[model samples]
Target: MYPDELERYHRQLLVIGREAQEKIRRSSVLVVGVGGLGSIASLHLAAAGIGRLVLIDNGKVELSNLQRQILYTVDDIGKPKVYSAAHRLSELNPGTSIHPIYADATPELLREVISGVDVVVDGLDNWETRIIVDKICYELGKPYVHAGIHGFYGQLYIAWPGKTPCLRCVFPRPPRRGNGDVIPVFSTTPGILGLLEANEALKIISGVGKPLLNKILVYDGKTGLFDYVEIRDADCRVCEE
Candidate 1:
């Protein structure tokens, strides 16, 4: 590590040690959305000295996004989300390279981006896109850190191909699309889940802690409770194939 890098990540090095820190510095992560969840997760990943980050999101910043998307400000309202996100994250950690893809997560696009990363993080809002990402990651054998938020509730799990149940194994089918394409959400919900997703990614890359595998962790902000649902391998064709 260079002198400036050592100083920038000094506190983190103390926690994970120099070897783990180096591992983190060499790791690349693909974040599949730059909204509420992606905003926070990618922020911490960059701040922690991740070597590279590929961010994909076709949406542009909006006035409504200020409620939870912390990466952008009023000035970024009309800009493409990935561009604004890349600008903010680059400012946070200039050493971490940011590749912002201002496009949709089509299968071809997902394949192109997922091929070069060490791990994949799901920050998508809808199930249709999430399922596509899960299948691609499983097919590519990448560690996928998954999370979802609705209202005051959220859930998280890490889907390790061949070793654990993929997202389809747990859901079987996508939940019905919410009313009018807008689901009520509390800002803190995605904030919490996103950070947890980042934490799992860090642990996976640094080899410092256990990941949430083979089980879904559900969080309820209303009651301040967290519950675990053990997931068994299902007859899903995605991973089974």
Candidate 2:
């Protein structure tokens, strides 16, 4: 390890030190969706020294995205998210390598990119895509950190394929249209959930903290309450019980 690396991550390396720092340096993470949640999650992972980051987002930065999408600013309104994120990530952590796949990367698209990554972060907004990726990840025996936000309340969970329950274990199928309706979210809603997702990702990468495996942490921004519910269903299709 270089002297500056130790100095750069001194706070985190304080407890785990060089060994864990090296682990982070050796691992890769695939962040699907460069929207609000994906944006923040990718930023934190890069800054934390994750070896390689593969960004997959098909959308362009829109004016409405500025309120919470921290990765892109006003000048980035029309640029594609994957390109913008890749550029910003490189600038944020020159030590890390970023692979930007600027396409409509779904589960199939993820196959090639995921073969070498350590963990997956679910930053997408659609449940259909989430279910598809969840199935593939669970089949591949990968760990994933997931989050969803609506209004001030959001939920996060960590699932280790076959061991902990998968996303489908909690929600068997994507909610049908108009089922839950459109849950409104403040600009910071995705930011909060995304930050929690980053915390979980760091814990998984460093092996220095316990992740939210098997439990869904629900946060209510208004009350500032965080409650957890154990996902005990072992008969889930995606999780393969």
Candidate 3:
């Protein structure tokens, strides 16, 4: 590590050690969606010094996003999310390389994007995109950190495809939507989950601790409760080939 790089990550170095830190510096991560979840996950990953951070999003920053999307400022409103996030992440950690793709997620695009990446962090809001990402990661044999947030509550887990139950195995299908068809989420909800996603990614990259593999972690900020559930799929369509 360079002298400044070493100094920048000094605090975390003691816990992860120089060898693991080196692995972090050599690893690349793909963060999908630069929304509330993506914003926080990418920020922490960049600060932790992941070698390459690829950000994918096709939306523009909105005034409403300022509530939880900490990566953007008022000036960033109406600008592409990937571009704004890249600028902020670059300023956060010069040692980490930032790659911003201003495009929507698709099967073909995902195949190309997942190439040469070490881990995929799920910052996507909807199940439509996330399921596609999970399938792509499974096909490519990549590890993925999956997380979602809603109404002061959030859930996350690490899925290793063939090794553990994939998202579809756990979900089977998307959960029933609310009557209003609106997700009531607080800003802090995604902030907590996104940071957890970043932490899980770092652990997987550095090989420092056991990844969440088959365990689902749920957080309820309103009640200040955390729950853990073990998950497995005996007849998983995606992983049971």
Candidate 4:
């Protein structure tokens, strides 16, 4: 590690050690979506010195996103999110390579992006897109970190292709999409869940602690309690294929 790199990540080095730090520096992560969840997760991933970071988002910054999306400012409103996020992450850690894809996560796009990525971060907004990410990652045999937030509640899980039950296995069918659904979201909700997602990504890359695997973690900010749900499917369709 260079002198500046060492200084920048010095504190974390104590916990993960230089060898693990090197692994982190040599790792590449594909973060899908750049909204509430993606904002926080990508920031920490770049801050932690991930060698290469790919950010994919299709939307532009809006006035409403300012509440929880920390990566953007008022000036960023009307600008493409991936551009603003990429610019900010580059400024945060020049050593970390940042690739910003200003496109939606189509099946083809997901396959292309996940090609060389070590891990996939599911920072998407809807379950439809989340299922696509899960399936593509599963077929490619890649590790995937999933998280979602709504109001005061959030859920997180990690899937390792064949080794763990995938998102589809846990939620077999997609929830009915409400007509013009606009669920209330607390500003702190995504912030809390996004960091957990980032923590999982780091551990997965560095081989530090267990990576959640098939277990799902749920956070209830209103009650200030955390719970876990064990997930496994021996005859899962996604996993079986």
Candidate 5:
């Protein structure tokens, strides 16, 4: 770490120590969406000195996004989300390298991107894409931190390839949704889940705390309560190789 980097991450170093901090500095992460959850998770990861971040999204900033997506402003409404987010993150931490991919997360792209990253963080809104990501991460034997938010509720889990139940094990099939249907969400739902995603990633990278492992954490913002569910391995094609 350089003198400026040391000074910039001094407070975190006090908590995680120099060795753990160095581990964080050398880690690379792949974030598959740049919407509400991705925006907040990537922001904290960059600030925490992640060595590299690969951001993927195929959308532009919109006025409606202002309600929950904190990465953009009104002036950025027309710009690509990946570009705008990369710019903001770079400004926050020049020491961390940011790679913005402006495209949908296809299986081919996911395999390529996941190959190089140390961990995969889910910021996706749809189950189709999330399932694809989870499958690829399991195939590649990478750690994946998954989180989903909807209408003042959220769920989080960390999937470890062979050690823990994969996402497919948890959700054998995705819930039904009509095409082009909009999901209702509270402004702070993603904020809370995104921070939890970042926190879990940091724990995995720095070896400081226990990763979520085989537990699914659920939060209900309506009642401000959090609950945990234990996950056991089942006959899942993705991880039952």
Candidate 6:
């Protein structure tokens, strides 16, 4: 990062360099669902110097969230995720603009937020919402990064609209909701995947290393093993013709 930008980003530029810093400064990302996944993704992006971040989440912060939603503290309980997240994000980096959309991600809702955004990140709770996001990203020709955490496992992939396969091509259906209830989970799982999503976002924005296009990076926290699954489907409704 340039000396002037360094003065702004400080520690962030030390990690990503000036060029990546500039890209982050000029990019806009819309993150859906400000829970465990969205919380840290927003934190890292804001701290990393992303210019505009639109965070959308309809849920409210509850006491149970304290274990993983590091962005919020006990005092924020009962507050909408968007409001709580925006408050914390503003404190994290005042220079990074935050636009909090306190609503669920429906087709229409997403369309409104998707405008002018360079990328979309799925920090959502369910596969139903993910499919909506995938179609919207495809329609708008924007890159969409998908991240999900189930118990101790988390996965992420960058869906480059028209170039890489969308989430549906790999899973074919939204994962059944509440499956996490049946799996064992540690708070650190989402933390890892959320940062991975942020890393993919930076790579996409920075024109740096190759993105996680068409390949899902799966993390097994129990074993600390990372696996990549190549995904391609010519019949993908969202990204394929």
lDDT tens per residue, model 2, 76-173: 88998899899999999999999998888666788777777889998888887887777778878888888887778788877777668778878775
Which runs in model 3 stand beyond 4 Å of their true positions?
180-182, 232-241
> Which runs in model 6 stand beyond 4 Å of their true positions?
1-4, 8-16, 177-184, 232-241
Question: What lDDT does candidate 6 reach at residue 212?
Answer: 72
lDDT of 4 by residue, 1-241 (tens): 8898889988998888899999999999999998989999999999999999999999999999999999999999999999999999999999999999999789999999998899999788899889889888888989999998888999998878767877888878775545666757899999999999999999999999988876889999999999998765534565565
Per-residue lDDT tens digits for candidate 5, residues 1-241, read 7899789999998898899999999999999999999999999999999999999999999999999999999999999999999999999998899999999899999999999999999999899999889989988999999998878889998877867778888867776554557878899999999999999999999999888887889999999999999875534554565
Q: List the candidate 1 regions with Cα displacement exceeding 4 Å.
A: 234-241
For all predicted structures, in order, the TM-scores are 0.96, 0.92, 0.96, 0.95, 0.96, 0.91
In terms of TM-score, how similar is model 4 to the real structure? 0.95
RMSD over all Cα atoms, model 2: 2.1
Off by over 4 Å in 4: 176-180, 232-241
Worst 10 residues of 2 by lDDT: 174-183
Of candidates 6 and 1, the better by TM-score = 1
What lDDT score belongs to each candidate, Candidate 1 first?
A: 0.91, 0.83, 0.88, 0.90, 0.91, 0.83
Q: lDDT-based ranking, best first? A: 5, 1, 4, 3, 6, 2
Q: What are the clashing pairs of model 6?
A: 1-17, 1-18
Model 2 misplaced stretches (Cα beyond 4 Å): 173-183, 235-241
Global lDDT of model 2: 0.83
Residue 30 displacement (Å), model 4 = 0.6
Q: Of 4 and 5, which scores higher on lDDT?
A: 5
lDDT of 1: 0.91
State the number of backbone clashes in model 3: 0
